[model samples]
Target: MNTIGSWQNHAISLGLPPNTPVKKQIDEFIRRWDNFR
Candidate 1:
């Protein structure tokens, strides 16, 4: 349900580097956020 723009914003907010691929960023972001819960 995430749009590209919002996905990128979430990735950035998660402190993930922009140089990586979006798929990777999303996966990592999910992992990190899950751990935080």
Candidate 2:
């Protein structure tokens, strides 16, 4: 079965621009999520 990778998956689907401020926030979140490990 296929599964979504992460928020970045949805972000990619939505065609969010990499330079957008909101995308920057999500990028920060992904960074924090990794640091939690």
* Tens-digit lDDT track of model 1 for 1-37: 3455665566666676656677898688679789999
The C-alpha stretches of model 1 lying farther than 4 A from their native spots are 1-18
Each model's number of backbone clashes? 0, 0
- Assess every candidate by TM-score: 0.49, 0.44
lDDT of 1 at 19: 62
**Deviation in Å, model 1, residue 26 alpha carbon:** 0.3
User: After superposing candidate 2, which stretches have Cα over 4 Å from the reference?
Assistant: 1-20
What is the number of residue pairs that collide in model 1?
Answer: 0
State the C-alpha lDDT per candidate.
0.70, 0.58
**Top model number, TM-score:** 1
How does candidate 1 fare on TM-score?
0.49
- The root-mean-square deviation over C-alpha atoms between each candidate and the true structure, in angstroms, is 3.3, 7.1
